[model samples]
Target chain A: MSEPIDRKTVESVARLARIDLPEDQIDDTASKLGDVLTYIGQLEQVELPDDVEPFFGAIESVNAIRPDQLTDSVDREQILSNAPDADGEFYQVPPVL
Target chain B: MDLSTLSAAELVKRLSSGELTAESCTESFLERIKDRDSSLNSFVSTAESAISAAQAIDERRSTGQAVGALAGLPVAVKDGICTAGIATTAGSRMLEKFVPAFDATMVKQLLSADAVVIGKTNMDEFAMGSSTENSFFGVTKNPWSDQHVPGGSSGGSAACVAADLAPVSIGSDTGGSIRQPAAFCGITGLKPTYGRVSRFGLIAFASSLDQIGPMARSAEDCGLVMNVISGHDSNDSTSAKNDVPDFTQTLNDSLKGLRIGICKEHFGEGLDSEIESAVNESVKVLESLGAETVEISLPHTPYAVATYYVIAPCEASSNLARFDGVRYTHRAATAKDLTEMYCQSRAEGFGEEVKKRIMLGTYALSSGYYDAYYLKASKVRRMIKHDYDSAFEKVDLILGPTTPTTAFKIGEHTQNALAMYLADIYTVSANLAGVPAISIPCGLTSAGMPVGLQLQARSFDEASLLRVAHQFQLQTDWHTRRPNA
Candidate 1:
């Protein structure tokens, strides 16, 4: 907590988020993110109660499984029409290899 | 004077009694939007079919056919909620061109109730920032003074109602998004309990914390909107199975028996003296109505903003992963492969705050720091929830200032990250605990801007919350004040 976060951490984390952080923004973005993290670091000061479950928002429901039935879905054409590159029934994407 | 200045209840009565045709009412609002939106920048886009839809409603009502409860009501909706044919941009370029194929559950409910969609109001991109300045469309100026912000992510929704562009509007709240904006704009907004309203079509910001609710000129108007919007949805599993109540039926509930709590943690150092007096004055008005106030302490409150920032972003990073340049959203044309496309699309699509949060989330959930950050934050979240749980045992509602100060000038805090996050200090605890809360204008600051008094209630207790808010509104005229726009 004593050390401010560095630019390398921002780049790696942005990569983890699948975002390309612009080179010019790295220094400023890292400094700001470091300040926020330092602010968030206050969480480290409090003692957490035992067995704190993973929060899934306000609703207490976890993995709310329902009957697996085929319900009406959005029309296929309507769904495809929104894709940036649609190939008839499927979304067309760049080559994997 | 124009019909745009009329209240929602008056508009509804006139529409139902045939004193005002639906088309004329819709046109009046559209005209207001045309006249003021250029200056306020509240709307992202207006519905082209609004006039014709209003005409249809008028025709149905005249022919003695059945019309819904919201017959002919013109309402503005935040852009984050999906509207079948309208663009559902969450103020992010990523979904800027994305037109939803279906109406969100709440929007569908509004349509069935005969409400007309006036337009999609502007918002912070993905409902992220505390000010609407983060929007891709452009900043929505505060209606009270063009120099200040109309608090955000739901900034546009609050401004629309405050400026009379619409009688009421729908807005989504993740952390103070709805209430803060409503406070900043001198209006009424409610953040219903987590499961109180269906989130089937609200664009996900933090799935666990996000909820859709109404913002209007009065709590009674918000209650009418809530009656249509709140209920269980099969499409959303986390939605409560409880039957929705008639919110309008509860407004007449007396304030005499209620015990509202005063959280001392909220009054200490960071609060502005002006907002403090305004909140103290609101307590007097409530007490005059026979309500009692008690002292309560939320010991864990100091850690709430820290907990929310950590927890919300972790959820956001995971939720926003769907924007991979493949289906339904913006895509970068220059990418040569799938991975490059994913990286490029999001980088270009999201604004600075969105990306910052996403990265922060990715880091917190990363292997080395997961236990130290996300896990610890989650546990602290429970501690915060426990504080509210214990407090609720002694009181029916908790009262505080919605914001530390009045609507600040735009760009004032945009450069300061921690300062921006600190603004939600008083409002985020309700979201962290999944409770219902509201913001109502109680007084004006010396600078002549509105000051909002916030009240929080236990989960699923919006009926009591709205009732108390309604009772308070009747005793004061703060909610009646409109911006010069």
Candidate 2:
């Protein structure tokens, strides 16, 4: 259905999603993802009223904002305890040149 | 009496009365988990703190310190909900070893209500799949049939209740994660109105569609759990500011003159015959109890699955981007650069289904495809909500089969992800409509597998929804039957 999402497309989408797909697995991934997209493609048949606005979430309420004043936060050391590699004050990551 | 077999409400009552000590109560359940869960695989990790916590609760009760609502009943939490000092994986390898620093708002509420958090239940990896097969942990088997799947994402939660591993559980539903599993496992599961419960520490799936709710053996237990969890929170902007009634207060309300809608489209193709008869019989039972059944239509029902796949994964892609190995969870051992680190860590950390969904979402939200996919699905999502809005005017609640069939054998749909997604046809619309829906066992099929009857009501109408389901349970013995462990 809809050409099984060719390997090239899988490669492109994987890049966008930031998941590195090994070359050997690309074809299988494309086909499986393609099957789901093809089913989702059934949406093409539903004719909607031209005036209907796209609904995002369940709530229609305006954003809830709070005072900008600084408040108590989780302990920095405790929060950093979950970090993969944390230094004294910050998380360690691959250095960007 | 096996303490594990009692409802969460009964356990709370007995514990508060000092008839059952919290230590003995927690230990009995911990024993159940220890003896039974090895076969069910319902728990990813059981808490070692449970006994000591129960001991503290016993001391508090003995000292005349006021006990909270739950009274120290052990409640299983879906792995996605953060539990401070406990490993919360969401069944993904990405967070396999990551322990949270703080409990989720609901977990905090459970603690405040005097419930003991016994364990984190297994789920589909990142709550992506229909079966629990996608968990980084091993697959959770249906207690009724070992070869079959416990319907997923919330499968382990359902299994824990079905197997009496825990009297009640917390589960998050994005699509049909909670309802479908509960249906397959023959337990009661409620997906409260989208904002009825706070989502402060739920590991996000599809933010809009995801709502945390309860799973148990009966609607009364679900209502009891809902009482402890539902309410607006300052931390969750989307949580409704509406007044939350005591969820359990209305459980015994009469169903006299209640209006139940029966949608013809729901009983259409792809449904199994046994499920059809079970639900049809349930409607008759409801009518016998003075409820009225009206024929209604949810015209947009056909488009729900398609719309959900697009919206859920799109939200998921954005939500899961936080897992890119820099902070919490899995990081790649080797990466040449930051981009490679992000890509490779995600590639290695996530399971196939999670990655596939992320890719599908990225493609849908990609430059040219956004209007055609995400925007169109959103508009159809409006129509799905509108369908519910129109139906609610005709009837107080909508009833249908929770899933097309009973528990399917594990690995049956693993290779066919789309087919697995289609199994959620009847349950996803409730999420799309942002209404409250519940699944309760109606009867067993000819094959001896359980069938779930689903009911949906207008948003924030969980009280009425629970009341109606509880009324049905009062007249039905299906809710009382459990798999022989």
Report interface Cα RMSD per prediction: 1.6, 1.4
Q: Which stretches of candidate 2 lie over 4 Å from their true place?
A: A1-3
Top candidate, metric TM-score: 2
- Per-residue CA lDDT of candidate 2, range B1-485, in tens? 58978888889889878899999999999998999888899999999999999999999999989988997899999999999999999999999988988899999999998899999999999898888999999999999999999999999999999998999999999999999999999999999999999999999999999999999999999988898899989899999988999988878778898999998888999999999999999999999988999999999998899999999999999999999998886999899889999999999999998998999899899988898899999999999989999999999999999999899999999777778999899999999989999999999987789999999998889998889888889999899898862
Model 1's CAPRI class? medium
TM-score quality measure for candidate 2: 0.98
Give lDDT tens digits, candidate 1, residues B229-252.
889888888799777899999899
**Candidate 2 chain B, which ten residues in sequence have the lowest lDDT sum?**
B1-10
How well does candidate 2 score on lDDT at residue B268? 96
TM-score per prediction, in order, is: 0.98, 0.98
TM-score, second chain, candidate 2? 0.99
